[model samples]
Target: MRVLLVKLSSLGDVIHTLPALTDAWHAVPDIHFDWVVEEGFAEIPGWHPAVAHAIPAALRRWRRDWRSTRAERHAFRARLRAQRYDRVIDAQGLIKSALVARQAIGPRWGLDRASAREPLAAWTYRHRVRVPREQHAVSRTRALFAAALDYSIPNTVADYGLARERLPVPSTAPGDLLFLHGTTWPSKHWPEAYWCELMALAAADGLRVLLPWGDETEHARAERIAVAGAGHGFVLPRSGLGELAALIASARIVIGVDTGLAHLAAALGTPSVTLYGATRPDRTGTFGEAQIHLSARFPCSPCLTRECGYRGASVVRPACYEALDPARVWAQTRETMSGSREMAHGA
Candidate 1:
């Protein structure tokens, strides 16, 4: 069967949709699958071996320029309509995503009101499947596929694209650790001082640290971490999605504070430890992996506030992640890495 999965925008959301690929592939082992994602995260769906195509759409960028943007959208819509897929699923329950799915070739499907992240997006789907609201993002994604294909889904980690590649990493490496400290939201970031301290602890334990960057903001943070570590860390050049897979595939462990890279590492089956602050990990935490971490002690946690609510709050501080000491994260990193080594040797 030929199917098209439309999920565009936000790196984390795109990563979360990956498990649905597994469901589709499993239901129809010879399924021909294609994906439509935003330009920023176009490399993701390609990581899945089952995906026959990864079509890049730049709705966000196209919206920037009035004339050229309209032309681009028209062109893309024409191309998408030409494919005439047998089935098109809108995993991303957003108006834009729904419209994109509507442009595809066949019967449209998506989650009903309760399951959709955005209720209005449900209007775009001809076949609506009401998913369990309580399920994790991964489960919801899989459920969407299950409902679309009328196939039962088991509680299994069906990661078909995450076959680990043997990228040559250093022996003295900190046991394959990847640190992701970048996000679109300022409130989501753990303090730079905390990251520096975490790096020191990793270096002390003889573990190698890897940093991946796609833009200037993350690149700057990576540079600061390297500088703070006194040249103890490694700087990966700006790379495409394939390079990202190569980098994460080599890691024995992944650590970060609620970023797409952290989630990607988890999706790739690398043991991941993610730190949560303003947003609840329950809504969007690392999944399909055994190793995960979260911190929700702050009274104002999961506020869903973009900027720290210090402006109007009486406390006037970044309460959510302010108290998360680097020492604790470092200790956890050490333990996780040690655990990976022990399991490897059966010690």
Candidate 2:
């Protein structure tokens, strides 16, 4: 079966869809996948054994300069309609993904109006499936694939089918910590001061702390954290998705906020602790083995908003993040990786 999968953008969402491909491959040995994904994350689909290749979609770029990008849009549409697929599945319930799925040549399948984020997206599919919205993102995608492909939803731990060893990551030494400090929302950021303290604590215990950044602001924050730590914490060179995956896969431990890299760490099966403040873990926390999720106890936590609204006086600016202080986060990280409360302080 040659399946066309339309799941575009947001690194974590793409990672969540990997297990569904694995399910399809296991359920039907002859199944192969060709993905329509954002050009930025194009390499990931091909990493899975079941995937034949990725057809890069530049919707984000095209939307930026729509008038000038007509030729590119035409070319992309041509690529989508080039080959007839056994089934075209849009696991992402967004209108953006639905538009791409509509252009693909196949018997289209997707979430029903009740299940879809954009109800209109369901109209494009020949077969629409109803999957509960409350489940984890990984589980939801798996259910969608099973309903579309006519297979039982495997009652097993999701297997991403992409191993850490697939990347050419270097061998990292023991007691090295990779801090995934960058995130999208202001409400999701664990305080910079908290990060510095955590790095300092790790360094004092004879650990090497590694930091990576995607933007100038993140680079600056990382630099500040490194300086305040006054130990082995240092900023790595700018890296791409594959390089970041390699880094995450090879790290001894990962401590992170709600970010795509945190999800990547989970996908790689790295020992990781992901901190949650404005967001809850029930729906979309990092899903994999050896992963720990720490959510805030603040009253307005899991706010699900991009910006903080609290005007109350608190130790932490976001306020909700105060529930997940540096000392607590570091302790959790140490305990998670060391697998013992005794080793939480790096004893």
**Judged by TM-score, which candidate is best?**
2
Clashes of 2: 0
Full-model lDDT for every candidate: 0.76, 0.88
lDDT of 2 by residue, 81-145 (tens): 99999999998988889989999899999999999989999999999999998999999999999
Considering every candidate listed, which one attains the maximal lDDT? 2
Give me the runs in candidate 2 sitting further than 4 Å from their true place: 170-175, 340-347
Listed in order, each prediction's TM-score against the native is 0.90, 0.95
Give the Å error, residue 2, model 2: 0.4
Sliding window of 10 residues with minimal summed lDDT for model 1: 166-175
